[model samples]
Target: MVEAAQQPKRRKRIAMVHPKFPPSFWSFGFIKEIGGFKTVMPPLGLATLAALTPDEYDVVIVDENVEDIDFEINADLIVLSSMAIQEERMFEVADEFRRRGYFVCMGGPICNVLPGRCRPHCDVLFEGEGEYTWKQFLTEWEKGEHADNYVQEEKVDLRDTPPPRIDLLQTSAYRVGCIQTTRGCPFNCEFCDIIVTYGRKVRAKPIENVIKELQAWADAGVDFVTIADDNLVGDRVYAKKMLKAVGDWNRARRYPLAFYVEMSVDAARDVEFLELIRHANVVETFLGIESPRSEQLKETKKFQNAATPLLDAVKIIQSYGVVIAAGMIVGFDNDDVGIFEDQYTFLQMAGIPIAMLGILQAIPRTPLYERIEKAGRLRSAAQGNNTLSVTNIEPLKMTYEELVTGYRNLFVRSYTLDAIGERWLNNVKQWGSKRDVPPFPGKKPEDPNPADEPNRKWIQKPLGRPRIHLIFATLLILKYYFAGGKEKRNFALKMMWGTLKLQPAAFMQTMNYLAYFIHLREYAEKVVARDEKFNYVFDDKNLTAESLGEDGHINMVKNERSKKTKINVNDAYDGAEVTADIAADLEAVQAR
Candidate 1:
């Protein structure tokens, strides 16, 4: 470990930049506008990298989504981390920094998958988890010896990881804080690249370390947090112990923090686990129920989802007071024309208010990518936005046109005002009705041997000083209540009434959902319009290996029907001027 007081012979200045992200379903700019924040969440990975840097180096972190980068600051090195969707902008940023004679270093998931494309722009590239590789790079650099690439052949144990440098962030810029509890998933879904990146063995931090981090956040006055785990409860025993510790920690402080997480659908089967999460004050979770058809699940090797009836499992989880945001994908090899309707009906029947519908894309090096590549059905590299009504692989049972059309229709129908309102009402009602049970029954409420309380308070009154965004959200909801048609007006009233009667916290959460719908509905419409302009055809009966290119991409030609349509980002809401600049900024990045 590097000591904080150590000083190198030569002091170095480093600038860490997080590249811009594209507009997508989860951009949540609309919600950010109403919630008085700039981004949905801070780039925790970049923050962690900043913490890993040697203490002698002066580091400054900049996230382009929150603020513009200052090019005037002189720095010895520039470091970047990004996803695949931000590849173009990332390259542009790297070129700009390299032009100014700064040594550029790049790493993250994108670099791991596409190192060949990323190598030319960087002086050094750190590929796998950086807990160990980063330290090695710093040591070598200080001695004037640096390599073009440093990849970790072995995964680092989670126990040795340090707390992320949250002090580097402008805390008020994001709506919620982020923390990662676990590293990998045990399941082998064909299209998933998680195991390829982090291995199949689940690695987690010790419970004491987790609590110490949470206590740090609590001291910093962070009220809402998002756990950025691939699967929070992949190992049931570890999860139970962690949740029990968290529950005890929260109860002692009067429960100030609320959390959100991502987990597999199998969590629904564990009623005891559900109650534990509820007691820990987890407000929501996202589950990857990729498809409703058993055959499709089998083809993708998502056996956990295939083993159970989908709707029953959803209801079972909601019965314990946690809202579910489901992920649905179409265009699998086994999906036919009817799969679209099946997906829509399943979400409606299951009362999932927030369903992320997408066409499947085979990421590079995953089992699905290898299978499709060998079958000569690959089309192109994934654009990293799976919900964009486009697929990168040729389907076996359906044409590309059929798949795009079905995906477009599903997105449009699912996010309509009436459709979303109905689902939200049902979900809020179900969540409100669930009884809050103690995770540890028959245990005394008092702590037997109380330790000294941290010299900080956790809870902050939300209604004390109303933010501008909250006021805007209120006006919009009221406008829909009074000016909308009878059905919308009635639905709005019932939502407010139910939330007030059951859980007051849910009213704000529901408002946030409505804000999200404003963005997603508009994006869906744009995708549908974009799809309508594409002209293509496929012949299933006469398909041949010659149709695919040497690089495993399919060759398709567009007809005269192809015409680009300009998309307006401000068409979804009535009072959208507050967030108009956000849309303009994203459009400018997209153009670059």
Candidate 2:
């Protein structure tokens, strides 16, 4: 190759990274002043793998979970992308960018489930799904032919992917911008791997490629964008012709960006595609509703959420004003020990302020890892360690210390402070006439990076049904200034200055549910108390499958069954579960 094209073109840079969950996997507090009124997310698949890289390759993205990855910025190639609760900080950022000689390159879904255990600190591992292995590793690194490992180009042609360089991000550490109209999830749910990583046939990205990505995120001033779909109605006539072509492309651009997606609560039987995603503003949605229990939804095959009743399909999709966010789970296999007070009284009677309950992890070529390694139930030292605090399956009934002490008493009774002031007063009274806004959707707040927002603080707007001493005065001064002491911070600063000197809308909805319950009570007491716990107790005769280290070689070889049963709770409150089919059956039991 003519001395590889006259010998001197190695200036390729790249950085990309993006991990950092501690704050208990961001249950709420992702800093920057509690994720500035929420909607952070931007790492859109490593900024769409740095926009299929190769503009003579320079890239720099670094989101160490929202900001601070500039390990002195200089780079020749680092590229990351995590998730397996971010493989121990992506193997300590690929061994500190390969001891700073720099040449890392890994990929996500925990390097597509173990790229040879990140080939001894990766020099390249781009496993599956990175829009054609990032343009064939940037056309084999502009033909110098770079390589160490790149075995997966699993694109599945998401409508010929592109458009995500989102102007090479950094755009003020995100407030919103993440797009995907759809891709995989037809429902097999055996502890999901999203159909073994985006399969079960359901891909989409048309409707003018999602209105030219909502007119390039309303010309990059982005108001909001997350349709990062696991299911934005997986093909219901192309999700109602892409929600009536995003409600006629935001009624011909008069509706500037604002959406959030993830579906299946049978998308409330498409009331005109939930009123065209509520006239394309799409306030919020996360759904999943894991188990309202139909025999734990046919023991996790999740038969399309057992033909819906998840609190009457989340109060008929929050009676079309949107906002619902839920996803619950805590060990499965016919769950009993009063399934954490029936999922904390079904998310405190389903007003679902934001559930995402966790714990039943297994992941790794799912079908619940080949039927819990063919019913041995798995865990012999959790084979091929894919860290999410090490859960490698096996719990057909209980004892992984009573399913991690009933997943820390289902997050100490679903984040109590009176269950976040009764699910923020039943989602501010069932989305109170859908956050009213009879007009304002045309785009006035186009403030992109307002000089990194000087002294920001907004949230007032609620205007009704808020009183109970301004809802416990900013959650009793953040439960006494984040529960440390100095006489409980002078009795929580004299009752949070006597409720901001007398009820400032319950001291701003208890300082917005105290920044999401101080990150869900420190991720329910530290990274879900380091997760993994299987022990079904079937004796692995004289133990030592090399006493399995890397994280329980398949739930300690499926807990060797020496006789572990113990699950017998009867009438914790009489098989409690509620549902009716639409628009406020008490707001789907207050979004449980």
Candidate closest to the true structure, highest lDDT = 1
Tens-digit per-residue lDDT, 42-63, candidate 2:
7788877787776876887877
What is the clash count for each candidate, in the order shown? 0, 36
Residue 198 CA displacement from its true place in model 1, Å: 0.7
> What Cα-based lDDT does every candidate model obtain?
0.71, 0.60
lDDT of 1 by residue, 10-55 (tens): 8789889998776667877544555567777888888888888889
Off by over 4 Å in 2: 1-47, 50-52, 55-106, 117-124, 127-145, 149-215, 219-224, 227-255, 261-282, 285-322, 332-336, 348-350, 353-359, 362-391, 394-428, 437-592
Error of 1 at 216 (Å): 2.2
